[model samples]
Target: MADDTSGLSVPPKKLSHSELKEYAPGLQPRKMTAKYEKQKETLLRDRKSIQQLHKQRVHRGQSAATQKYESRMERKKIDREKKLYPRNREWKDADYFIDQYLKREAQMKTERVRARKIQNVEVKGNDEVMFVARVAADFECSPKVQKIFRELRLYKPYTAVFLRRSGENLKKLALVRRQIRVVKPIRQQVEDLIRTRGFAKVDKQRVALSSNQVIEERFGEHGFVCIEDLADTLMKGDEEKFNLVTHFMWPFKIDEAFNDQSNKVPGVGRSAADSGRHLQDKVEQFPFRFMDSLMEQACRRGKSRHWMGPELIKALPSKKEAKFLMKVKRKKVALKAKERKIQAKFDAIAETDRKVARKLRREHKQQREEKKAAALASKNKSWKVAMKKSAKAKEKKEAKRRGEDRRLIAMYGKKKSTAKKRPPKKQSKVE
Candidate 1:
């Protein structure tokens, strides 16, 4: 029992450095082994530090060593690239521009998917089927808002595009609600949209309609025979058919809302969304719907189908009618020229008469001013003459009195003839 206790109590000895080195060759110490390991650690630390510093310097473009390495790598990469693509290996400004353009277009196509999507959208029973149209021409919207407009194909002011009343579409329209006008779908307007400003997809290209045959050819399988049928399909809320027709149709360009009214396109400069009257309210208050008014104007401007019929009261002008119109235009032009000539002559005579009247008035004023000045000068001259006459008379009377005094002195015989000397005629010069 005592020997078992001693054996069980004994602990294992730790391995010596020699034994560790013998088992693991890497653990063996050489000359300056500690110093070497220390130096290795220091070298590794310095290398890591250098690598970090090199990364920073490369980012700052301040590392010559990194620059050289990049240049070498670039040369190798260029060589590889040249081997890979030798046909159009030369890069130019135009190539760069084309690359940028393709990139931007691809990015735009991808970015269009980010608008809010509505799931399980439905057109329930008794729900009014309506479409929204953009009326404002503000293109300086936010990127997301502009992308929404671009997706809707409303590129300019008064360009109308039909929008379904789906939740997703409603959300998209709400983003640009201030700039757009929502209205009750007018059948006439929709027909006009398809007839005049409509484009159909022909061979995957947007081409204007030549006849109802184009629609029949493309949508005949879907039972759309003409423009009216297509418009009817859109109105019935058939999602698949509606999307196809809208996609085939180009954006409809219309005139401004009214002639005199300024285009109060919301989101242009100020927040028109918060303005006094909502755009929808204003649209509802209009005498005719915005699009209907536009359609009316278009109908008036376009010749009637009746006029295109067999009747000859107001048919489209033929060559003979065109010549007659030209002759009438020339005669009208001659009459206008004569009227302008007569008006010019009358204007010239009136202008000359006005000049004469102005000249007479100015001469009369000058004459009155000159006469007053001459009258004042004459009065002053008369006063000067009267004073000169008075002075001469007084001098003559003084001379006579002096002579009488001299005669009295002579008669009296006192103070002798200290008498008076008369002035010589030449010295006096009394003329």
Candidate 2:
């Protein structure tokens, strides 16, 4: 009974560490053997922290990549916007151009007045310049456009030139804007292009301007002794000096296929995924689009290079030429109307002749068909008569043959019933 009661009784309440120590007074609690478990817990916390840091690093990488991609797309969108030129704004009629010219003249007057008050300079038409490159990608251009290209020394695809703005040059560009690319090169770009691709005309032949002596020998009369002198004159934008220097130098040859920047010091010309974007950015101002043309881009102000002369304004808008063109256009319209009236008269006569011919063809076809029907009916009637005669002859011959048989049968005394006999049976084996 005692053992059963001890077994049945609940164990004395277990004390916590502090309670057991207080109850025991001087006795110490057992040291915990959970070092391995504590170590595992600590390891788990450290691993969790490491994983968190890794997640953050990965997230940062992903975010940076996303931002870079988005920025690139945005830049492409802006480039496309700058490059796009609507066709409706491209080719305006004489009336629209006349209005534009009048407005431009009025605006120029205001600009001149402003310049006089501010800078005390007597501003004239316009000081304009441009970089022209012949793409020759479009061959369907007019002969006039080709003539302009030849005059500008843009003889082949990728041929390039620096053209100072003038009324004459503007007219040429207007005639062949779609077949060319126009750029407004800055000082740095101009220097690079000249140093890398400059040429001199010697004895009516293209020679590279690699040395100052060659430049001095070719252009010494014009005081352009060195390559620097040539570049300086061009940068100055003087109409006369610019023209002489450009004609003196052969047209530049740019590579549309090789887009990578020419080799130079590592970081200078290199960029992330450069892929010739730096070079492409040089011409981003006047983008190559189907409807967009350099002639139109000359009007818009941009960040680096801008149009500042009346050459493009007057030429693209056809300032003085608009009136003359309008008169010629009226004459052309009158002539076209007269020609259309004459064509209408001829078409009416042709239509009448076609109707008469069609009626004659129908009558001829009907007469031939009628003759063929009569011939076929006569042929069919003759064939039917011949068939009838052949049937009668056959019946008479049958009757004669039957009479002859009857006579022979009578003479032969009934001819033993005259029936065909069956073949004899084979002899039996027993027989």
Candidate 3:
């Protein structure tokens, strides 16, 4: 019988330190050899059994769950199909449906007609000429506006009518006699016509059209008629005629006329003063007013004192002064040509320098990239070497630890076997 006051018994040890070293160098001190080995084997077998049982349970649960889910999903699919394909009549009345359908059709037809009308209107005035005509009508009505209409009629084959601003009152003019002539610049002509009629009198409304009217009318199809015929008719008597002639000849500048002494000509009398002043005025306003007349007279007299071009230049005086002026002009042109050549050379040198700088910058950038790659490669190689060394050290340490663990286990096994064979300890009674 066991004593009630006694403590639990410990297993006996068999192997000593030297004995363990001779028999099994792997064994540790103070361990039960046999019991430890037995316990280790039992623990390993239990672990494998538990793993197998857990795996079987998981597989059974997954199979049952999947079968249940599939059955539920099949029932739901059948119910959804039944709902989508109903056999009963959901709408029993046909009269209301037909009326709604017909109403929608009528609405669509009306919309289609409206869309077609809009498309037709867009196509009708798609040309640029029509577009310009519409834009011109937006501005105030003037002679210039009429002139634009005339030009549009002359150039475009399409017939366009201008509408007056008095609420859609459109006027369709006849294009049967439309003709365009490149008259001398009409602005200058208007200015001359106004100036020759006396600026003060013209400003005072002596002329039927003011300078602005004359300018605006020049652009008009019939405005030039008022300028040529109306203006000539309005100027009556000698004073008015003289003032008109002078104004026409000296439109902008009155100072360009020669002095009275310079106006003297061979066999010319006092009566010719008026004619001379008119001729002087025409000369002062040359190219602006009577360019064609000047060109013709210059051609006839063999004197190139005209405003035309080289033909007129040749007709100028063949004196020493004129020759000297031509030489000076030639010298200035030659100097300009030399300056342009020097500028070209400087531009070429600058372009070459820019290209060379760009090339050097590209090479420097490439060198930087190579250097960075070299550094990164060196770093990677060093890291790989360090990792290999660390792995080898870890393996060595693990082998040493495994050897120690085996020694401890073997010693424990031996001690356990010895303990099982030892005689039981005598116990005292505690009655």
* Highest lDDT against the true fold, candidate: 2
Give each model's whole-structure lDDT: 0.62, 0.65, 0.44
Identify the runs in model 3 with alpha carbons over 4 angstroms from their true place: 1-237, 241-318, 414-431
Query: Which candidate, 2 or 3, has the higher TM-score?
Result: 2
For all candidates, the clash counts are 0, 0, 20
lDDT of 1 by residue, 7-116 (tens): 23332376677775555545445566787899999999999999999899777776676889999999999998766767654555886779667865754563343232
Error of 1 at 82 (Å): 53
Question: What TM-score against the true fold does each predicted structure earn?
Answer: 0.33, 0.36, 0.31
Error of 3 at 80 (Å): 64
The lDDT-based order of candidates, best leading, equals 2, 1, 3
- For candidate 3, write residues 367-409 as lDDT tens digits: 9999999999999999999999999999999999999988998
Model 2 clashes, total count = 0
303-392 per-residue lDDT for model 2 (tens digits): 321443442343333445668878988998999899999999999999999999999999999999999999999999999999999999
